[model samples]
Target chain A: MHSDRAPLGLKVAAGLGLAFMHLPILLIFVYAFTTEDKSYQWPPPGLTLKWFAVTWGRPDVWQALWLSVKVASISTVIALVLGTLCAAAVSRTKFFGREVISLLVILPIALPGIITGISLRSAFNLADIPFSFWTIVLGHATFCVVVVYNNAVARFRRVSGSLVEASMDLGANSFQTFRYVILPNISTALLAGGMLAFALSFDEVIVTTFTAGQQQTLPIWMLEELVRPRERPVTNVVAMVVVLVTFLPILGAYYLTRGTDTVAGQGK
Target chain B: MTSAIRFSGVSRHYGDVRAVDNVDLDIAEGEFFAMLGPSGSGKTTSLRLIAGFERPTAGEIRIFGQVAQGIPPYRRNVNTVFQDYALFPHLNVRDNVAYGLMVAGQPKAQRHGAADGALEMVALTGYGDRKPSELSGGQRQRVALARALVNEPKALLLDEPLGALDLKLREQMQEELKSLQRSLGITFIFVTHDQGEALSMADRVAVFNEGRIVQIGAPETIYFRPETPFVADFVGSSNVLPPEFVAQLTGRKAHGALRPEAVHLSEQGHSATVRSVSFLGAATRIGIRIGDVPMTMLLPKSDTFPKVGDTVTVNWAAEDLHVMDRA
Candidate 1:
């Protein structure tokens, strides 16, 4: 429908809609080096790399950046393991309430982020768990698993059941089949999913807001700096870094998945 | 000394649908046994049962006299070449071939040498670095065959391994597969819907129809002495005529199956009119109507083909006719 040469009105509407969605992001990229301090000015008087140098030198900025990387990496790893297992179990096995289990795994992310954050916060409070690196990792994993699970499950479904049978018939046990056949087939999907999960975890703030008590991740740190008047350009600098770090892999994930229509898109 | 594999009264049912009805078969060691049938004939199901992919409903399956009931596929002494080949897309030909050995915990050096040898056997040497996607359909098929055959199992179950290939490739691979089986001296259970594939390659063929084995014998026996109408019609190009047409010829049943090649276009025998003539390269197949009954007769290219409107005499030897047990 989008490819069709419709009236100029429809094409202009679509173009405008796309511009509306991305214009703010484009502005951030454009204004990251602008001399203007507080509010974003369209026509900046001058541009400089001074903010990037300042952003690099700040110890607090480095701490928050490192924390974000650590949390995203740890959460992505955990999510990859658990989510792949969940996908394999659901896809390869026939069990009662399989659909319900799948829905439950994806439910945390499918619901509004605020809802997920509030509920997770309540659950953690009731369990008497304090906020820490582990808590942040755990909270991020709840949604990150959905991403990995979705990727792995879609890849698993693309793999033929007969391939597993052929592997077993050729003297591969379940583990060997998984290692030699199943793992290789699903590796791309896992990689794509992990990259996506890392990106999501890196930028996630709503869920982190309720979970993190004192630890300020990069996004949280950016939010704090955005509110305060001092060092506002530094937030834009950090935002520029965040965009670069996350955007590359999201683009990579799209190319990896867009080659074939994944099984996850079966109904849609 | 004993048969390579045996299935005694094996049956598989999915709820009410009997996928494989009670079947009894004994495949001799080193013999190429093929299951020839149309789709949904239980040939694949029987092969899977022997491979231990699924357990029989109520019967015994033995691999070299060892009961295979409840035995998992990995533990069984058999490998399968699936219809789609199922070659691991990530692994190259060599890795895919060595997968079974690697899974068996064989050392890397030994497995690698074995893999190289297997790839050489399949004429896929120097293809170890290229993934399955890089190979053509025929190359992929060879890789699949090498992967399964490298394990040196007691028997190999090929489930329509040539089904995906075009006619030309299929025929060429059929010869290669037969030679491979012969050289290895491994018992082979091949399943295919194409009768020509089964007849040309197998030492003996089992004809299947609707989840049951209709007949089991050598290719000659199946072609010449079919026991049922299904086998007669399925095994080769045959003309099934009602028993009344051959009543005067044979005093038995009211139906018989005659091979197109067996029916002659000579100047002697039963009288008929040429309905149509099809020039099929080396052979000319003519359709003839004899007293309201239509039949086909195959003749060598050297023989004169009767025109469509011409009258021709179509007949066969007295012993060439086989009575089909009409169900």
Candidate 2:
């Protein structure tokens, strides 16, 4: 009886917090179905299924959507390789300034995104490098690596060192040990980290702003369409698409890293 | 045949701390040798050095007459069962056991058959397809054993392999391990801090103190004729009589070691006041002070012994008190 009543206030507060956070997302969903397209209206004139067809035909929308997916995919791959390597070096070895190097790795994500963007912009200009698809990918990867590094390093430390030693003792070379033992142990963490990095890169606007010269990513395209009025509901339709694209990976990342505390020799 | 492993003046010093100081040792093929000491006594370090996990700072290591220094652990012809049984959590029991063979490019069908045999040897025949986390502590230990045994290594290095089990389980594993070594006839070198474990299982024991082997001998010799006070006090907790007291009794300026069970209550002997009494299940241990030196005697449960403050006459056979040649 005490448990039932004790959590009543907690239940109400939790409900309020959920509504406060999700109300805007609900508006995006509602606007996507509204019939009025020229201006914002509190209660839509009518609801229709016209914008879904409108969104499918726009070639510019296709271009921006393709660009965003390509950038996110390339950035996530780069982050997985470099981030995993850095995590292994810092967690598995003892060297002078090791702690400081780990701290510097996370600094990109910890600092303001605008600060990273400004630094990258200046660095590109100083080097006389032209901004393009690869430049934006590089910018996204800076923060993406931090995500993968955080996840990989934590899992690496949680794993027992003796697992590697045991593999080597069983007559495995360094590469064989990594393939047969270390890789399987850290695979889940890398997958989760990669998913989160992909989601982050997909929705990033601040870094893309300083890095992209003439490119219009999906989010940037949405911004331009919102300023100069066309079919307004089509932008909401595209927003709904973006929401679906980014939300699934974050959910996937959450489930991947959950209940993964079982390390080798952890039975006792 | 040449000895399975030999260390000639091997030393591993980290800064000023000698983790494994200059050590010379040998173990014959098909022999079970144990390195025994308290923690921080360099026994485990010596095992790691033999496994090629740590390189010695000076001197040489030879395995079957081949220079072993600078060789990677993967290149060495040895396998180690780590203290906690590091079984891969991701792999099932069968795959974990087959990992060594799989890494060596063995055919899948062949390696699986070998893994089955290895598992059956450890008496875990039908436990494949279960992850390491599903197994209990004892079962995980068996899986680790099977994994190492599948490789058929020339020598097996066990670093306190039974340390994590309960008392009864530990004793059972000790017996199983001894019989397994006998049947396999492979050189087995294990490091442990338990004196009873060392004396019971090993053919020869190396007692380490402060990164150096202070005494190396058979169990009976190590227990009865410890060369230094550290070994005398460490192994079985024997009574160490001071040099001055030994000189007074034997006219020899050397230390003496007397077993607690050897001390007898007699009609005529030196009188000592009982300081403490600990009643064990099978025997009662009595602590007494003979002058300034404290000594303990183990009396059987049925024997009539004095109370905590009572004065008693204690005597022992002359051979029971072994004098150390080097004090």
Candidate 3:
């Protein structure tokens, strides 16, 4: 219960915490404009925009970025369809082992990324499936579905059962009830979930590393460029772009879900 | 003439728990009917069954003499004003009221005109553009009623639609709903746990207890001539005389039920000592002990009300006493 004017100690601690989290990202932005061609330097000798032209000239960077966008978009679409259905089934009905099914759906995201990555890699090898774009999309969707399901299920539970019954009783069949009543209630949640799932899939690196065999997603390319330095500022510039691309949706999702808890006639 | 809605030997069970047990009822056309009961008393279950939200475990439900065994709610010619007034949050009042028509593929201009008419009926014509969240509780309730009535179904089911309002608003809405039903002349089947609500608004009320219809009759008949002890105690405040007590007083081995208002404070009859006196605005309720049996009597409020510890005599006309079997 801190007041509007927090204590001096708390204010300083909060500042330190934020700085700890964002200092490296700030450094990435600063280095993206630096003229340094080889290694990172404090106070970056001088700033220049030449790296933007060089990054744009690289076909490999374009390939990786396009691949990453494709994978995240397809993964998000898959997550939305499957996640909404799962949420509807879990929240709207009672069945045997429903809780177990919910637990299983969330387990992929809860487990360590390396474990998920390894399991996917081994499963792909055993099944004789090639490590391609579809494999990377599959790996990202495993966790993306969890994000969407979490948001959708919470909203579904909040929508009153009476709303659905009212729709049906007012001469709307099951399909119409979902379209008019259930859809309007859960639309914001589904949108927020989709945005969050897209953001999560965009910058994912560990899972992509295991699933991608000759293909390189944006994060994978950044890793390779870090190992072998050639026009180093280009990597930093690309990293800055990745940060912006992922940050916008996450921020948008936060605002979308902030006011979703208050539904009309819910308390009454 | 066909009954508006009929349930024949309907029994709905969830595993071993019987929600509605072998209930047979007939609601006449253009009559205001009420199913009155406490929580878990099968009243709400009966409403849902009629709405097609729940199927009966056995027997049949008929609408206008046609079997509604497998009919869905949308296909059945009835709409429900849900207890919580389940208005759509995303839509404004006009869109919410027009939803039933929109689903039926009515033209936009026709549905909008019909929605305005429905809103006007509820005295909410100017509130069309406002969201459900923007309306007050009473206003939202009217919108829900408008939404259901816009379809002009054969019968309308209301599941405690006034349960969420404050006391004053609830009383006001009760009168409004009764007058609205009269003007519409459509069959209304209402469900409520509040006996006062059922008594005030319904043409005939069904008293339910433990998954059975304990008694069904007009409000006056239910209050004065209850067929069972449960109905006698539930429909109103009544003194149910035990069989032994009745035998001692009337010299007959029978049970009796009498309303508190029926027993008046008198100069001579059955002698009793006043144990408690409660001043209830328009009336004074005096609790007394007549030999080992406790009884209550309601008397007109006056300056000469009896005080506790005072000895008094209470009397009732023979016609006021209702004979009933032991339950």
Candidate 4:
């Protein structure tokens, strides 16, 4: 291996950085099993499985979880359709203001979440559209589309233009060329983008807070529960579930994109 | 003979740049034709126009006596082997070869069998299951050939197909491609920038320069009797003597080209001093200067090589001189 090994000082700093990031999540997991119900206590006096039963029994928790799942799924589907089309247009063709259009597609994610939240809230009010489940889904899809488009555009650009031309030369129509040549080249990237979009939508809080006026997504529900602690340990258990839900897809997306970097006959 | 492909006043323009200016040309059925030119000289554009990848800005193209305006490439009865091979990375060799049949909605078994046969024709019969990435560069090139041949179009357009291979492999593939074209009896329209490749493989060649066809003839004629200064210089190494020099030698005030091989280092001829000598296996290329005009001569290698600054007389037959109008 030609890669140089990090010094002991750098390794120590990396270890400290990772612990600082993940230690709080570990704390959340630990407190979920704490016997104490009123407040968090370090190295809990006792441990029990009562919070699991308590979280399972809460109807509000189930409702919020279901709502979060529904919003993320719908948002992911919308993002995939809109993002792939936008990526194909921006990356494959030249037109007036094409650079401006690409910039606008990416602006939603690059801007602060609060700015996106406020803009979406004002737009909804201007249209007189009432806040509902679809409002939350639309809010999440704004940023979700950016994630999907970023992944798709990069992959589309990497796909050789000659491949499409060769397909047509081999007697394939535009649609057939897309089906045989273009789609296979971009499928993994699209899948990774869709997964990332889902994960982002599932855990979104800022935009959902403004657009979802009366709707209670899981993150919104957790925020509400944090303000009024009926059962503190139950909230910790729900936070554990949220972490697992978001982490799995992000991990899957990473693996999916890693395998796509070595496309056949690429760079030759 | 029926003309397999014809272009009448065809021109393709990109904004202000005319990639292929108005040109008229024809290729007979079962002829191995080549379009030879430098980059951006419109040879590839002409091939693309025939393949339906580019629409002619002005004029008409016909394939097998039918007008091909406004037709898409998929509907055209021609296939192209791209310079980069352009093999589908996600597909195995068999599926890549079967792509056209798949697009036509052929049954799986029939397409697979035909694909195998195409692979056999390219001498890659048992390598169908391999991915394009798994094969070597030369093998990948064969797969690309098989992919196009499986479609069995009336004409196969090869856009510098051997450009990516090394010189040795390129020479080997050139012969194989020629044999393949002969065996298939399909009109092959090959585009290349290499003059040697075009001359060696093509039955006839069209020499292109600045979006125009300067000359079209058999390889020997194109090399020996180029119609213009551009064809004379671009087709091979030639000393284009000034009209004054031609007038002095042949009593005609005209421009003429003399092949280096025709200029022999004789004991009594025009005296010139050798500037440089380079061995080329069976022959030696000697650069000489005569009357302030630099000339090249290819002489048979002998025991005593000519040293730089050695004065020698060069001569050639009048029949070897091809005269043209001054450009």
The weakest ten consecutive residues by lDDT in model 4 chain B span B318-327
Tens-digit per-residue lDDT, A1-268, candidate 2:
3554647888899999999999989898999999998997989889999999999999999999999999999999999999999999999999999999999999999999999999999999999999999999999999999999999999999888998898899889889888888888888899999999999999899999999989988998999999999999999999999999999989998998999875545666
Clashing pairs in 3: none
- Candidate 1 lDDT over B1-327, as tens digits, reads 579998899899988889899999999999999998999989999998988878889889889989998789999988998888887766776778898998888998899899989899989889988877778888888888888888988898899988878889989999999999889999999999999898899999999988889899999898888877677778886888787876767877557889999888667877898888899898998888988888888898784568998987777887788777654
lDDT of 1 by residue, A174-220 (tens): 88888877887788899899999999999999999999989999999
Interface RMSD of each: 5.9, 1.2, 1.6, 1.6
The runs of at least 3 residues in candidate 1 whose Cα sits more than 4 Å from the true structure, single-residue gaps closed, are: A1-67, A93-110, A118-139, A211-216, A228-231, A251-268, B246-248, B266-269, B309-311
- DockQ winner between 3 and 4, please give it: 3
Every model's DockQ = 0.40, 0.75, 0.70, 0.68
Among incorrect, acceptable, medium and high, the docking class of model 4 is: medium
Q: What is the TM-score of each candidate against the true structure?
A: 0.85, 0.98, 0.97, 0.97
Could you give the fnat of all candidates in order? 0.65, 0.79, 0.71, 0.70
Give one digit per residue, the lDDT tens place, for model 4 in B23-45: 99999999999999999999999
Docking class of 1: acceptable
Winner on TM-score between 1 and 4 is 4
Clashing pairs in 1: B243-B254, B243-B255
Candidate 4: which stretches are off by over 4 Å? A1-7
Residue A216 displacement in candidate 2 (angstroms): 1.5
Better of 1 and 2 by DockQ: 2
